[model samples]
Target: MNSKKLKILLSLFTLNSLSLYLYFSSHPDHRRLPSRSYSVSEYSPPHHPLSVKPWPILPSYLPWSQNSEPPFRSCEAYFGNGFTRRVDPLKPNAESHRKISPSAGGGGWFRCFYSETLRSSICEGGRIRMVPERIEMSRGGEKLESVIGREEDDELPNFRDGAFEIEVGDRSRVGKKLVDEEFLDKYLEEGTIDRHTMRGLIGSIRSVDATEFVCSEWIEEPTLLVTRFEYANLFHTVTDWYSTYVASRVTGLPIRPHVVFVDGHCQTPLEETWTALFSSLTYAKNFSSPVCFRHAILVPLGYETPLFKGLSETIDCYGASAQELWQKPDNKKTARLSEFGEMIRAAFGFPVDRHHIPKPASGHNILFVRREDYLAHPRHGGKVQTRLSNEPEVFDSIKSWASNHPNCKLNVVNGLFAHMPMKEQIRAIQDAAVIVGAHGAGLTHIVSATPKTVILEIISIEYRRPHFELIARWKGLEYHAIHLRGSYADPPVVIDKLSAILRNLGC
Candidate 1:
């Protein structure tokens, strides 16, 4: 009894399953799902839509477009491997319209298309209107009127005082009209300009005769005397050089043409380095010869880039005309030379502007800069001048760190910079990824280093300055500084701290 019922149920289930399958097969979504797939080679081009106009690429060559180069190759390259072929605009039944109106179908069409070199939208050729007016025609007026559907009655109205007669006239005069009494009176009444003036007790003339082209009295360009009167520090000297911008601003010159009259007292040997630094500004050949001036501006050390508070106050002593450039809200703190930096880079061509120059085949290098030659601190004593008491220990730590990282190479560079040429210095800095040194003027070499390079400054508690910090920030380098406690000749080194920083920076 159970076997017979089970067979009947199975037969009903099979028929129901067959009916459901047939229904789904005929559904529109289901039919579209497994639509015929074709390879790029097998696919055929469809007809162009009525909206787009066909621009044929024919044998008779003509300057069809403003640009001479075709963009098909670029477009094909932009679409990587397995991209569908471009739809032909000239083909009567091209499938270009499928990509034209994204709203109509799938919307991810590469929208740029060029015909003969003229870029045009796939959907843009429909009912384009420029203007609705009667354009002028040089040919027969009657023919143009007929084409424009305008009758003789529709001609523009010609206005006249008496008879409807007016002729197109030619020019009667070449120059400006004569300024007679009436014209002069009209202008005088309007207060536009006052050409007539009384000289002392003499009365104003009615109308003065105009003269031929003549030169007016020349107004002298403002001159600035930038004596080497600034502080003798290297940072101060660099900062003072940038302060020349203030002189430029006061003179109203475009960075050039201003004379940097460096008096011998505070002058450094500007022959090599100063020339490159001040290349954007003009410098006087010799400061010994003084030029006579009816009116001249004197700029002092503390005027623009004052290291201390007393500098700006000194500029005020020169009377009301002297203004401090750094004090202004527009001028950033200190003498930040964005314009000068660009000029220097362009002139000397330091700081190579490459994103990825390969590392030297010798090793992954980290520079340990030596400051034994030049002392950045203003302290006079030789004992105070020498920083990093345990140089050998610090050097060994760096070497040990390098040894741990087999690829890294530690290079100790000190008096080498003073000896090497500027180009060689640039080359050395450009290749190094990380620079380590005591807080000193030697760290300024980071300026020539490639961007994104790391700067590790070993600082002394007694002498802390943001000179190199500011320079590092200006040069777009990663700066990390660690302070050591001591006032001795060489500051004590924290070996563990140094090791951690080196490891964190990937040595």
Candidate 2:
């Protein structure tokens, strides 16, 4: 009787086991065990849902920190290999300290410290000393110039006919000693000073004694030290902003650092734009007494740093060459320039990564950047030289063409950047499918354009330059040009070029 009962139970158990296996295999979602209490010895944590997530995580790729930011490690780890160069405190002026050793991915040289305190001592005419550290005055109270033995080259050379001639003669000896013909040619054409000149401007690094200067106010957050030009031209400002971004990336700050403009220049119209990119923005002049930063990064000038070069040049800033600074090593498909463009768009709170997305049925946006008379600064009257003799006529013709185009619907945008707020201007540029403009600073907005955007720059014979052309190439955007015989571009010729570009883009 016991043998027969055991046999029946064994057969039932085998059949039940087979049926459960089949059910679980077919309904895999139900395979997970139901919630239940377990003994301490038997308990095992479930795997994280995100553990099997796919590649190319968006938030991880962002240069700036987000919620649950990564922990702050050593400067070497944060800045990547070979990006941070330690300055020998004893021999700060040694030859090795003059240049940062090169590394892959080409991020510009930067010095980061867990804590750094700088004293801003006011000089004559309310200009704060621009040196990295405070200088010890001789017992006789000698001026900085007498102590350093060379006058600072803080002022950019004016390239006007008379000023240019005077500058060449004035710097003739320096040019002969520190630079070659090609360097001098670039200096003359682009107003770019060499490394030696930049070094001279910054002066020698003196003793860093926090006790020497009193701190009236202290900035507790991480801060970045940036030197900028006095004027607010869009091109120069872009270089400064880009350099700041590179500094943020290389330093590996978990959060965006507060930016301190170390220059003595008064506030300009563009200062508002600078304020938006960081946690805070302050000028050297703003500190009535010496202010100290808890954690500081002294960012080198983009002009002198190899990570990006040719800052003063009318052509694109050496951004295209500094792929290491912008492009993540793992992602080779997106251009480094485009990464920077995305950074700027994100900083300005504009929609990002929308360049390659399919367009709506209505059609593409053709943005025509218009240059008009406006007061850029206090010194000059509100009068801009006419680059396009008949700009209004050309704009009208383009508008007409966009409306009549049969291939696809076209939306022509009159990009009157001067009248628009900075955010609105960026929005217009980022949203455009094509940007058209005469040779002007307003055209610099193309740096923030979407990847798929096309650029059509009209160069008058009088103002021929490669600024926008080089930018388009670096950004991997399609670019075209219309060469005008004079300051005037024929409307029909521009329309033809626009039509051809749209045709190629399958408009």
Candidate 3:
């Protein structure tokens, strides 16, 4: 019972502890659990690892040197009349092709072509460039005097009506001496001739010639030129993103094209949700420093671009039409809308190829997209128009209903998208079995929802638009609409509609 016995006991205890440590180290799975344990939430799914492929990097060489490269051709030879094949004008889906011949001295020429099926226009080849600020047209290495040369008089082209200079004394002018009034006006006009129109005009009028421009960087791969809307609304932004995807598919690009935003207007930078869809993103102004691409495709905005037209009577559904272009007969994997959604999810490191998965055993998430007042941009006053006057009441009703549901687990998620990160918003949408929201831009997240997810849009009579319905149709998701007689939807009515929808899903 003295020092000798204590030493013997300590030796036995130390040997046992060392043996256990060594055993646990060799087989770590046998380690004892910590006092605190974490539980997986029924509604919060695990995030998928980032699986985006690296973007392709093309070689950049000195201007004239790259002309010998595979895709690079002399401007004169490329835009020659004989270079392009003539299509029958009478054909149903005939493409409209306009050829601009080189001026007398031989500077640069371009061909503006429009596809009827895609409803998009693209111009190729030219020497003289007519940008918004500068208008330079060269013929035989000589700068042209006028847009159309006349033998009698040699004077610069006049653009008095279209162009205006900002007066120095004008109060609107903070410090700038000169401002392009034409560009400013066009930019301010929301639906009219915007930066996209100007880009198209410049691309058509401008010429890429061997005589004047030595391509600084000759991009060999086909590039997608996207002109985004100045205001970054989710609905319009989705259209632009979809157009880029469709352009890549139609053009037969082996891989997704590197997206280049051609518009100089910088109202907002690309949102994080959309940035991942592109292999790479760049600005057209980035190329004005004098870069040339072997092939550049300008994707049209939204419905005009291709694939799907929103609420257009002439063509209600173009998703199927676009599917024909890329979906191979043997390939059972990709559907047009589903593939686009997957691409976005993959970019954000979300689970892909889950379109056909069964509902979770734990529960079904009912995501209620809550619209809140926040300044979307600098011009915004942080006051959003009320689509649902009783949004809070409606949300509370849904939450209460979910908590009381008897048949199956129903988890209610308040999707405050504006306050959450884009990836988190996407995760919420992916987790949801049903998404409910008033007729608002927030409902645009339906484009990213899982295939099995259902959409319940409560449209006030004042806001009875087919925006979400059309999107649901295109995405092949089940859609339900509660046409309210006024701005306020009765919570009881909304709950009833939701109950019916859930009952149909066997919930």
Residues 151-260 of candidate 3 have per-residue lDDT tens digits of 21111222222121111112233223122345323321224333334343332332222233333343434466555543357777877777666555433344455765
Q: How do these models rank on lDDT, best leading?
A: 3, 2, 1
lDDT of each: 0.35, 0.51, 0.51
* TM-score (C-alpha) between model 2 and the true structure: 0.61
lDDT of 2: 0.51
Give the poorly placed runs of model 1, Cα more than 4 Å off: 1-224, 230-232, 245-259, 266-271, 279-303, 306-342, 355-364, 373-384, 396-404, 409-412, 415-431, 445-449, 473-476, 487-507
Error of 1 at 289 (Å): 4.6
Q: Arrange candidates, best TM-score first.
A: 3, 2, 1
* Candidate that would win on TM-score: 3
User: In candidate 3, which residue pairs get closer than 3 Å at backbone N, Cα or C atoms, i.e. clash?
Assistant: 105-140, 108-127, 126-207, 126-208, 127-207, 127-208, 128-207
> Compared with the true structure, what per-residue lDDT tens digits does model 1 show for residues 1-507?
599657645654554455446534322121222124333233212212112111111111111111223233221111111011223111111232323321121101111121221111111011101111111111111222133432322232111111100011112211222123453232222121121110100111111111111111111222343434233344555555544433333222322323334222212233244455432222332212212211123342322232222222221111000012213411122122233333334445554234446655665556777654532122223233656767656766666655666435545443245445555555666667677777766566565555446787888776687767656654445778877776332323444554555565455
Q: TM-score each candidate.
A: 0.41, 0.61, 0.62
